[model samples]
Target: MSDVLRQWQALTASLPVKALGLAAWLLAMALVFGLLERRFPIRPQRFLRQRLAQDVGYYFLGGLVPPFLTVAATAALVWFASGLVPASFYAWVASLPFAVRVGAMVLLGDVAFYWAHRWSHENEWLWRMHAVHHSPTELDWLVNTRAHPLDLVFARAVSAVPIVVLGIRQGNDGLDAAVAVYLALTTLWAFFVHTNVRWHLGWLEQVVVTPAFHHWHHANLPGTLSRNYASLFPWIDRVFGTYHLPARQFPTTYGADRELPQTLGAQLASPFRKPPS
Candidate 1:
């Protein structure tokens, strides 16, 4: 039994082993949330078979997204900063305790994503890319995965580049583990936030992003088109002045006000085409 335990500990340190563990956790979240949505849909939503196929494709594809753009950006950053960054800084970060590294990842990741999410709304080219996400007429529990690959790539690049660079600037012993844990939290919470669950977790709204807050962000209503930009923490929006949470009422409608192609391929291709006048 002791020898078996030692072998398990050794396997845990392997990156692929850690990845498989993350996958199992995500699958468990999906199963739990899938049941909850059926029992407590906050609002009625449409879920056609075609949409199911599209989203299922996205759900799997999302797992493959981060590494592409994030890795590229990390490589570019390293090439550019090699001369300026101190080698010892990364060594120091590697030496820190695990909990501290994870805390920094959450704090820094939220800040990075908040700005990226907000910019996707204001920037024309990016909005064109991001508009595919808002194209969903209603929020499915899996709506988190319905994002365009480019949009996912870009949002990911924005979130990762800074954190990894900071690690490189300082050190990165625990950075990989921290990022993995943060991404897992971010992905799982996304399902809950987009679910049809009737949860209005009252005061909890002040602590973190909730379906109420995110629902409003996607709301097509007059006061809601461009508000509530923070992805993880509500306080960040509160500080930056984009916060727009209403305690009791939820948005009655959702989706982008613009025209979007109905088919997945067209929607994917739409970003490259000229916008409708």
Candidate 2:
């Protein structure tokens, strides 16, 4: 146990060391999920020609960089836009109890995300950016992070960042705690929904977004395209008339109808390329 303690001590000694620890944790989680997929894969061919490198690149970029940039850019924008929103408006939010404030923050974030996600589908130019996420042919936990930078930024701005920035501006003491809890909750949920676990939560599917539910959103097959946009709550999709969770069914196909570029660089640039006639 002395060696283990020494390794732990070394890992915590510096910021880079801590990051290496995180990278190790991430790899372990990937291995765990990969094992789970092998045992309980939703599709039989889930492992066939695994796009390991392409997805790992996106997993890091989308999971780490985009979210950090979202918070940073939001903080900057809120600083500039603070003059527009009266201090009294957010002063009230700052005064709420911890539980209530986090609850409100989550709702505000989810609502913003819901609308922005819908807009990504409805707007063509936005779809170009959003398509990178839907280009996956296989469904698994790692696919959750395969989003475009624009897609991640836009969604965060619409949902979580606004509430967070407001909390920061309003002098909320628990903003850090709230943001951490919220990100934790969201990251867990995102991975859960993208999982290869063959689950169908009989009644709860009506309330929450499940892997089966989101698989439909990624489904490019007949009667399964461009629907189920809610990130956490399925009821929001019901309200918006985009919800379509067929009983005891998963999408047969997983990808956009058209082919997206295979390389990470090319996929990033594909959004900017003009659609071929």
Candidate 3:
């Protein structure tokens, strides 16, 4: 108990540093993406549009997202996959060169994330939680932060748990560093793909996911929902038969069909409540 208390205190001690770092990163993202959107927006929108404040709230909330996701994913992994795989396998994977492990993790994580993301759309209960993210009528880089923490945990755990289970183990700084790189890559890419910029990458869209590909995933229009679930790679969606990108086109509308709570507190609590009749 004393050990646990020490760890908790240590974590709390680090919050200010983490929060400062996050604030700096957020400021940079706003400058870069904000300029891009203002110059080449897919859809015209104000710099300070409606719900901007709420999304800014989400920005800070998003900083806490990864740790919770990691904890939930690790706990789930130990609960489910414990004793299923040999210890030697994890050690062998961890023994690989740092670059190799990071490369493998990016591929493995995206594949896992693709299926998990698709399942969130297919599963009714998951959709209720995910709907909070989809409730935004406007899309931008900030929109990436607007997610239900529970939904974020569940969908990400499917990908994250496997990475934790199959590769990264505790106490190995090298493996831990690799996972951190993977997380940074995926998280930055998410912000890019959700940005409102109109600059399409042409053939690169086929290679990696672009705003065009992911915006379609967020499209609330008829026949556009549930396509393009892969977060990093576009091929995963193609392999899974969920890819749906059109040439020189973009989604006309964005958001979920159902009405969702607009405020942060209400959005967080929404998943546990029944939908209005």
Highest lDDT scorer: 3
Each candidate structure's count of clashing pairs: 5, 0, 0
Candidate 1 deviant stretches above 4 angstroms? 1-30, 46-50, 88-97, 168-175
The collision pairs in model 2 are none
Report how far residue 7 has shifted in candidate 1, in Å.
Answer: 26
TM-scores, each model vs. reference: 0.82, 0.85, 0.91
**How much lDDT does each candidate structure score?**
0.74, 0.76, 0.81
lDDT of 1 by residue, 225-266 (tens): 578877788999888888898767777788886888878778
Per-residue accuracy of model 3 over 2-37 as CA lDDT, tens digit each = 544565566668888989998999999999999999
Global Cα RMSD, each model:
6.8, 6.8, 2.3
Residue 183 of model 3: what lDDT? 75
TM-score of 3: 0.91
Higher-scoring candidate on TM-score, 1 or 2: 2
Which rank order by lDDT, best down to worst?
3, 2, 1
Give me the overall lDDT of model 3: 0.81
What tens digits encode model 2's per-residue C-alpha lDDT throughout 1-277?
3544554455346546545655785687678877877787888654534786777777656654564556555666666657677878678767777777667777777877888998987788788889888888888888887888878888877775667556632554766776787787788789879888888888899878988899989997875666888888888888888888888888777887667777888888887898787
